[model samples]
Each structure stands twice: as structure tokens, then as C-alpha cells.
Target: MGTAAVSIEHLGYRYPRQSNIFTDLNLQIEAGERFGIFGPNGAGKTTLMHCMTGLLSFQQGKLSLFGNDIATNKKETNKLFGFVPQDFSFYQELSPVQNLEFFGAWCGLNKQAIKQRTTELLEILGLADVRNKQVQKFSGGMKRRVNLAIGVIHDPRILFLDEPTVGVDIQTRNAIINYLKELNKSGTTLIYTSHQLSEAEELCNKIALIEAGEIIAHNTLDNLLSEHKEDGLEGLYLNLTGKAYRDGNV
Candidate 1:
């Protein structure tokens, strides 16, 4: 099998003064697979991403990328993936170009290389028209695009997105999804979580349904559909999660 793009074994986590979030969680994403992680609120979907990206530290178990432990390799392993969080992660006061330049430098790109990559990304993300406008003035969709551009400036091999297309117009959403499709076609493995099941169905071939920090079901889209025979991802999701109210923020 191809080297695992992401691997987690016996992983566990908890917050101060609260109950444990994960206990002995295990998961693996193969290279070149567009893997989708799904769960209701409080399911630990975002938490898992944070742990994978080194945003949060776990006291137990192992998390690795390309066989290198993230906790051990730190900087080197970080360079292998990109992240676009659910919230806007760029400097709102800076223009798209300025933000890209600053973040590109943070990613360790040199002057010429940073400048070159910035130009290319701005063009590709359709931000060239307003590259100089301060990001704070842009619409939600526009800002989301800028966030995506900054996230991929270095062209990471594996991209992790937490609701990357949330709160955007349909047109903007389509633009972002299409761009991501092209990127994945070029061989970037994707790890994503989103509420838009239809959108996820369009892009992801493999999926893992998580609840309370544990994976309850994992398989390719076809297999999942065949096994449950639900109408779609949403149907399967509701079937697995049930009809009870979920305060995901908890």
C-alpha cells in the first residue's frame, strides 16, 4: 500500500476540567485519497485536525505523516501539509498580495520565490482584480478565497480544511471547489470536514464518520452507500447519528 499520508493510533485527548474528548482513537488516510471526516457538533472533527496540524498537543498515542511523527519532526512535518481553517485566518488589514507575501515568508519562502508564487496564486484564486484592496473590506466569499490562497501558497502535499467553503455564495463556493479538484487531480491528498454533504460527496471518495471523537464508520463512498443503502451521505449520517438534537458547540 502507499505510505499513509496521515496515521493516528491509540490517540487520546482531553480539556482541562472536562471529560476526555478522545480515547484510543485510530485512523489512517492513504496517499492521494480525498478523505472526508464527518461528525455532528462536539464530535471532535476539528479537534482531530488541530492535533494533526500540531495546533494542539496530545498526551497519548501517535500521529504521523509520511511515517514521521508530527510531535518529533515538528517543522519538517508541518511543511508537508496546508490548512484552511473555518474562520478567516489571514490579516484583515493587509491586501491579498501583502498577506500572501507575509505568510509566504513565514512558510520560509525567499524573496523571489515568494513573489513569484504570490503572483501565481492570486491569479489562480481570482484575487488579481483586487489584490491590492485591504482584505477587511472584501465580502465573506472574497476573504475566504484569500484565506485559501494563503493556505496553499507553498503547494503542500496534503491539504487539511475545516469547512473551507462555509458561509460563501454559491458562485464562490463553486470556484473554490473547482480549484481544489484541479489541485487534487495533480496529486495533493485532501483531508476535509464540512456540513455540506452534497459538496463532500462530489469531491471525496473515502469517508470516516466520527462521533464523540471515535470513528464509527469508515469506507469509500460507494461502499458506505451500499452498506447502508441510505439516500446519500446525509441520509447515512442521520441514520448513524440518529435524530436527537446535537449542540455541536459543546
Candidate 2:
């Protein structure tokens, strides 16, 4: 079998002056699969992404990206994935073209290649007309598109998205989803987390539902649906986590 796109084993983590954030977490995301992680606000989904991408450290267990251990091969592993964080990670002052050029250079793409990709992404993401305008001045949806464009500048094999379509117009959301579908269709693996269960249902073939830092369930969407006898992800989540509202930092 091919090496998994991402693999985590017996993972454990804790925050300063707090109890364990998660313990005994384990998952494997195969290549070409759209994998989703769903949970309440503080379920540690984003934290897990940080650990997988080397943004944060954990106390125990192991994570690997395409067979490269993140703990021991950080740089090599980083080259295998792209991450779109929940918050905007790019400079607000920079124009879309400039931001893409800078990030493309950081990804080691030559000048011509950067220009080509910048133009293509701008057009494909519907930002061509505003490519020269400062991102801070753009609408929420436009900024979201810019964020997505930056994450995909290098076209990495795997993409990690954290609530990527949040707070956007339906048009922009659809555009983003369509682009992501095209990417996954072309064999780019996806690791997605969001409160948008309906969207997740449409996007992910496999999922791991987490609560209180524990994986309550994990499997293919079809299998999970059958096992839980739930018609939708939202129903399954409610069945598993109850109806209480959760509060935590995004």
C-alpha cells in the first residue's frame, strides 16, 4: 500500500497550567482522500493541525507526513503540505499579486514561474481585477480567496483548511468549494475542519468526529452514517455530543 498522506499515533498534548488537551489520539489519512475532523469549539482540531504542521509541540506520540516524521524532518515534511489557517495569515498591506510573488519565492519558485502562477490563481480565484489592490481593503470574501490563493501558491500535495469558507458570501464559498473539489479530484489530499457540517458532508469522504479531545468516532462517511443511523453529519454530531452550545477561542 502507498504511504499515508498523514499519520498520527498515540498522540497526546497538554497546555500550560491546564489538563491534557488530548490524549491517545490516533488517525491515518490516506492519499487522495478528503479527510474531515469535526468537533465542538475546544475539541483540539486546530491544535492537532498545528502539531501536524510543526506549528506547536506535543508531549507524546508521533506524526508523519508522507512517511517523513515531523518531529525529526520538519523542513522536508513542510514541503509536502499547505495550510490555510482559520485567521488570515498574510500581510494586509500587500496586494494579491505581491503577496503571491513573495510567498512563491519563499516556496523556491523562480520569477517566471511565480508570475505564471500568480496570474493563473488570480484569474481562477476571481481576483484578477483586484490583484493590485491591498488585501485589507477587499471584502471578507475576497480576502478569504486571497488567503486560499496564498496557501496553494506552491500546489503542495496535501492541503489543510481550518474553517476556510467561514464568513463568506455564498458565491465566494461556492467558488472556493469548487476549486477545492477540483484540487482533490486531481489527487491532492485534503484535511479539513469546520463547523459547517453540511459542507463537510459534501467535501469529505472520511471523517473523525472529536469531542473533549477524544475521537468519539472515525471512519468513512458512508460507514459512519450507517453505524450511527444518522442521515447527516449534524445529526450524528448532535447524537454524540448533545445539544449544549460550546464556547472557546476560534
Candidate 3:
């Protein structure tokens, strides 16, 4: 196996008003691995992602991306990852091609390269016909596909997606998941957090079950099943996380 694409050691985080969200978290994701992070709301799933991408600064612990320290080598670490946020926003008036061109330029790709890559990505994501249509006119599924294409246009080695299919129709969700599987098969390391246990079962080779700001379990799907002697991930999740309400006040 190749070197670990992401390594976290004794990582911890906290907000000024809230106590520590994650404590003493250690994880290593190998290259080309499709890893899933499953957690209830407020379990620090997104917080951990921020720390991994160097978006949030933590005083304690170490984080490395592709062997480079994320804290000390921010630029190099960021360049090695592509982030697809849950709530993807783009210019409503611009077409898919235009939006991709702008982001591609920002990534330092030349005009010709940007155009070629945009065309290829749109086609691959089944957005070729709508490439010229304004994003505001597209359906939710189309928009998600466009968002994914933009994220992968630069071809980074690692991809981070936080709930990429939160509120969409079943067909759209399936399409998005299928595309993600293709990306993984083609050698892009994927790390994502999802509430959909069934989808995670289908796509993730390894999973981390986190709750109450701590990781309760982390292992391959087969091992997790064998250890728990459960039939599915949902059973294991409920067994570990419980069914109690985790209500929060804003």
C-alpha cells in the first residue's frame, strides 16, 4: 500500500463557548482509500474536517497531509486536497462552463487547459448538454453534479466532501453516489461524512463512527461487522450511538 494520504495524531478542538468537541483523535487514511465518517449532529464530524484541511487552527496535536505538516506547510497541504462543501454556492447567472473557467483560472490553470478540462469534466459528470445553461435554471441534481465537477477540475489527489447529497431526490442521490464511486475507482482518495448509513455501506471501505465529540469506533466494514456481529452499519451505529435525542439550541 502507498503512504497514508492523511494522518492525525492526538488531535483536539474546542470552541470558546463550548467544551472540547474532539479529544485525542487519531486516524490514518491510506492512499486510494474510500473512508467514511459517520456521526450524529454535533459529534464534531465537520470540525474534524476543518482541522484536516487546516481551516480551523488547534493548539494541540499534529495533522499531516500527504506527509507534509498541515499547520506548518499550509500552502503545500492545501494544494494536495480538493474540498466540496455541503452547501455549494456559485454564480447564479453564470453558466457551468463560465463558473468552471473562473475557478480553473484561480487554480492557476491556463486558458486552454481550463477550457479543455471543463469540457471533459462536464461530459464525465453527464452535464455536457447543460454546460451552457445558467445554473439558476438547473435542477438540484444537476447543480450537485456541476459542483462536483468544479471540485475535481484541478485533479487533486485527495477529495473531501461533507454531506454532498443532503437534500436531493433518490435518483439524483444515486447518480451522485455512482459518480463518486467512479472517481474512487479511478484513483482519487475520498474522505466524506454522511448521515446515510446505507450509502456509506455501499461506498466506504473503512468507516469511523463518532459521537458526542469522540470516535467510538473505527475499522473496515467487514471487521466492524465481525466485531459487533451485526448485519448492517445501521445496527452498529444505533448500538454505539443510541437513539436518544441530541437536541441543541441556537
Candidate 4:
């Protein structure tokens, strides 16, 4: 059998002086799957992604990437995935080319490789005209594209995206979604979290619904809808997690 793309076993996490955010969470995502993690605001969806990407440390259990222990082989595992956080993760003052150069270097790409990759991403993401322009002057959609380009510079096997297309026009959103679909088609395992249920339905083959830091539902989108007798992700989400205010900022 092939190794799972992401494996979480009895995963637990909490911050100091705070109650447990989540405990005993277990999930397995297979390679080449477009997987979505959906939940209400403050439901620990971002926190779970952070843990998986090694941005935040967990207090218990195991996280593995393709069968390698992340805790034990942090360096090795780090090279296997890329994380595109919800926030702008690049230097706004820098040009897209500059940001890619810096990030590509950080990922161990040499001068020639960085130059080639930077050009490819600029053209592919529609940033070729503004390749040398500072990112701060670009529109929200352009900035989002830059952020995504930086994340995948090294072409990691797994990509962890947190709200990769937040606050953009429908056209830009569609462009990003199409690019992501092509990436997934090329065999990159995607672990994504977003409030866009309709977008999630369009992108993800499997879905996991979380509330209060726990996974309440996990299955293929079709199976989840069928088993719960719901028509779509929204119905399944509300049916499983309720309509109460979350009151969480995690």
C-alpha cells in the first residue's frame, strides 16, 4: 500500500493557561487528493492546519508526512510540504520577482533556477507585467497570487493552504481555483481550509467538517452528503455542527 499524504494520530493541542483547543484528533489524507477542512469561525480549522504544517507545536500524538514522523524528522518533513497562510506571507515592499528570489533561495534554489521559476510563476499567475513592481501597489487578487507563488516555489509534494482566495473578485478567485486544480492534477496533495463552501464543493473531493476543534464529520463529499441526507456541504455542515455562535478566535 502507498503511504498516506498526511496522517494524524491522537493529535492534541492547547496553549498555556488556556483550555484544550482540540484533543485526540485523527485523520488520514491520501496522496493526490483535493481535501478540504471546513468549519465555523474559531473552530480550530486554522490551528489544525498550523499543527500539520509545523507552524504551531502540538502537545500530544503524532503527525507524519508520507510515513515520516514530523516531530522526529522535522527537517526532512519540512521539505515535503509548503504552507500558504491566510495572511500575506511576503514582503509587501518587494516586487514579485524579488519575493520569489528570496523565497526560492530560502528553499535552496540557485540563481538560475530561481530566475527560471520566477519568470514561470509570473507569467502563469498573470503577474508578468508587474514582475518588477512592488507588491504593495498591486490589487488584492494580485497580492494573493504572489502569496501562492511563494508557497509553491519549491514544488512541494503537499500544499497546505489557509484561505488562499480570501477577499478577491470572482474572476481572480476563478483564476486561482483553476491554477490549484491544475496543481492537484499534477499530483500535489492539497490540504485547504476556507469559509467558501461553494468553492470547497468545487475543489475538494473529500471534506472534513470541524466544530469546537473536533472533527465531527469526515468523508468523501458525495458520501457525506448521502450518509447525512444533505444536499451539499452547507446542509451537512449545519446539520452536524449546529447554528450556534462559535465565539472563538483560534
Q: lDDT per residue, candidate 3, 113-227, as tens digits?
A: 9999998988877889988999999888788887888888888789998888887788878888888888888888999898888989988999998887778899999999989
Query: What lDDT tens digits, residue by residue, belong to model 1 across residues 1-250?
Result: 8789999999999877778899899999998899999998889998999999999999899999989899899999989999999999988999999998998888888989888988888898889999999999999999999999988998889999999999999999999999998989888999999999999999899999999888999999999988999869999999998879889653
Q: What is the TM-score of each candidate against the true structure?
A: 0.98, 0.97, 0.95, 0.97
Root-mean-square deviation of each candidate, in angstroms?
Answer: 1.0, 1.4, 1.5, 1.1
Candidate 2 collision pairs:
none
Clashes of each: 1, 0, 0, 0
Indicate whether candidate 2 or candidate 4 has the larger lDDT.
4
- Inter-residue clash pairs, candidate 1: 41-248
Best to worst by lDDT, what's the order? 4, 1, 2, 3
Summing lDDT over every window of 10 consecutive residues in candidate 1, give the lowest-scoring window: 241-250
Task: Show pairs that collide, candidate 3.
Answer: none
**lDDT of candidate model 1 versus the reference:** 0.92
lDDT of each: 0.92, 0.92, 0.87, 0.92
Candidate 4, superposed: residue stretches over 4 Å from native = none
What would the per-residue lDDT of candidate 2 be over residues 1-250, giving only the tens digit for each residue? 8999999999989888788987899889999999999998888898898998899988999999999999999888988888999899899999999999998898878999999999999999999999999999999999999999999998989999999999998899899999999999988999999999989998999999888888999999999988999999999989998899888644
Better of 2 and 3 by lDDT: 2
